[model samples]
Target: MSRIGYARVSTIDQDLETQIVKLKAEGCDIIRSEKVSGASRDGRAELATIIDFLRPGDELVVTRLDRLGRDTRDVLNLIYECEQKAAFVTVLDPHVSTRGEMGHIVLTVLGMVAQMERRFIKERQREGIEQAKRQGVYLGGKARLDHQKVKDMHEGGAGASEIARAVGCSRMQIYRILQSNR
Candidate 1:
């Protein structure tokens, strides 16, 4: 049986090294990873590939249950899909697995807890932002894109592709900026 590791980070700024190290130490035969949110399965091509490539007796491993997914239904569906393929899942951090009936029960409860924790985190973040706004201290998050730079470049007759490269953003973003200024 092959132990295939899957690592994921919620954002591009987050590092995957920690998860990678744990999976490696766990003796994962192959590792697939991506920088994407685990809130849902969307935009997780690497994960989808691992699931599709799974064979009987294969093991899908991750550092934690949250790394698998933040949504309980998504996690359970992933586990079910792996099981349907005659494969199983191994959670390194919690040392959980879906190797037997008991494992399934444990993972189910853990999945619920992970989802609940995610909701709590979001609720807390929202509350903090609201408090900051009420105190007039919320200047809002810094813009990653320079709208002024984009405007100047576009006004200078630079094409969408040129502005995109110069601003280090997508052409779609450039188009939106230009359109909004019109």
Candidate 2:
């Protein structure tokens, strides 16, 4: 059985070295890596690719369960997918690996805990936003640049790359804001 590794981090400033080193020590034959926020569903290309590459008798290794997915549902879904392929999964640092019936039960419990945590965080965030609105305080951060200027730049045929560089933000950030305005 081949040990396949996956590593992820939320931002470009962070490195995947730690995860890579650990996975290598764990005897990973191949390592998939990505720099993307866990909060972003669109940033799971590497994850999808790694899952597809897994096969029977192959072991998917991750530094932590969270490294494999965003939360509980995501973790369970990934585990289920691996099972469907007859693949095994192991979270090295946590010393959790699915080998049989009891392991599945533990995975279920862990998934539920993760789901609950996510729900709690979302509820608190929603409550905070509502409280802020009631108090007439701003809920969102200030825009990086004036909207009219951004519109003018867009109208003048400036690309998102140039606009974002001029505005001191990311191209994806500028694109997302512009797209959401429509």
Which portions of model 1 show Cα errors greater than 4 Å?
Answer: 145-182
Local accuracy by lDDT, each model:
0.92, 0.81
Per-residue lDDT of 39-86 in model 2, one digit per residue for the tens? 534667888887888889899899976677557767887888998999
Indicate the TM-score of model 1: 0.83
Q: Please tell me which predicted candidate would have the highest TM-score against the true structure.
A: 1
Q: Can you write out model 1's per-residue Cα lDDT over 1-182, one digit (the tens) per residue?
A: 89999999986568999999999999999999988789999889999999999999999999999999999999999999999999999998778888878889999999999999999999999999999999999998877788989999988999999998887766877999989989
lDDT for position 135 in model 2: 95
What's each prediction's TM-score?
Answer: 0.83, 0.72
Task: Indicate the TM-score of model 2.
Answer: 0.72
Number of clashes in every candidate structure? 0, 0
Instruction: State the weakest 10-residue window (summed lDDT) of model 1.
Output: 164-173
